[model samples]
Target: MTGLMAGKRGLIMGLANDKSLAWGIAKALADQGAELAFSYQGDALRKRVAPLAEQLGSDFLIDCDVSDMAALDRTFDALKARWETIDFLVHAIGFSDKNELRGQFVDTSLDNFLLTMNISAYSFVAVTRRARAMMPEGGSILTLTYYGAEKVIPHYNVMGVAKAALETSVKYLAMDLGPENIRVNAISAGPIKTLAASGIGDFRYILKWNEYNSPLRRNVTIDDVGGSALYLLSDLASGVTGEIHHVDAGYNVVGMKAEDAPDI
Candidate 1:
């Protein structure tokens, strides 16, 4: 049971640092004996990702900018050359101009909107296409999303809209790939103080609000997210696909803030 992923190999995308949710999932998977390869968008992240991948007994780092189709082709090509197939893919990539993460969603510029959609939402589609090619026997694909996609979270802005699209893509892709026994799912995780969360406006307030109001009466950490991800990526979720599973400490179910909660 402990070696659930003992014979598996997969790719990890969007690892930034130790505190990243991707790092948490990678550690969990690696601890269960999953061999991993990592993708970094640029040279700076390459340096950061290399040591972390090495920590998991992997040095398979590839340079992939999902926004660029050519780079994605090269990424899978590299994987093809090394591993004939992969068992899973973890897509934790996302981005938006920090300037736009605040303010009203109506103020979203066309350029930024397109960029956010392409990187945050469509990148999953792009990478899944490549990953599916390598998963002839079928596999699992997981992406990181947020509760902001389902309901409004102040200042979540364009990223929320993008995540909405991402969640839909999971369903569509799941249908397209299910015949091959491939699965697609998303984890709508709760707040965690990672590098990405730092960009959101009033993030501290949002964290406090979730802590006060969520049924668990606290925010979730990357470890919490990692465990759920492990279940989804493992055979434990063999029957699960096209699901937007909530790892939000039951926050998504609440209709209103807790009556006894302190006002943020």
Candidate 2:
């Protein structure tokens, strides 16, 4: 059980704490004997992420604010110098102004819209561009998404639009990198309480509503999302590319709430 990824190495982003979905996946991957490197957005998170990464036996921590080119380049350069061939890379970063996340989609400012797309959607492309160069044997790239990408999640607003584009990019990237054997995909996770999720309007109601109505009759956990991520990143999913795998406790598949479930 520990050997599925015994010699594989990868990098993961978006870990804010032990509760983060990225940390969950990192723990599982490390438990399965995969060596890991982690990136933090700034010095504060670096303080937090660095200790956990080391506890899992990783000295591969780098400071990478995805929006910065020099930082991104430095992060990958460190990995390239250390590991000549890598197996996977995970992109779990996303951002949108708190003000815009609560209001009508029409009210979203152009600045915030571009900012959200740049950090949330385009960062995947920006980092992958560098990460790809280091993966001479090809590798897996997985990003986190939400059902909001395909359908409107109230108050999700422009972030939803960014996710939709991110999903599309996954497919196009998969094809572009196929010749080199690198696979690209995204995990469309069910809602989980995170610092970012707290920005959305009516988030509390969304959580309760989803648990009572989804097919699994419960909300998803970080562990659930992490396991799905491990599968996509590992060789187990070699043939799975350009796909959006859902780990949302059957919530995304529902067309309507059950008759007994309360209305929104």
**Steric overlap count per candidate:** 0, 0
Local lDDT at 217 for model 2: 90
The residue-by-residue lDDT of candidate 2 on 28-58, one tens digit each, is 7888888998988888888888888988998
lDDT of each: 0.94, 0.88
| Tens digit per residue, CA lDDT, model 1, 1-264 | 349898888999999999999998999999898989999889988888888889889989999999999999999999999999999999999999999999999999999999999999999999999999999988999999998898889999999999999999999999999999999999999999988999999999999999999999999988888899899999989999999999889898888989989977
Clashes by residue pair, model 2: none
Q: What is the lDDT of candidate 2?
A: 0.88
Best by lDDT: 1
What's the lDDT for residue 185 in model 2?
Answer: 94
lDDT of 2 at 132: 87
The CA root-mean-square deviation of candidate 2, after full C-alpha superposition on the true structure, stands at: 1.3
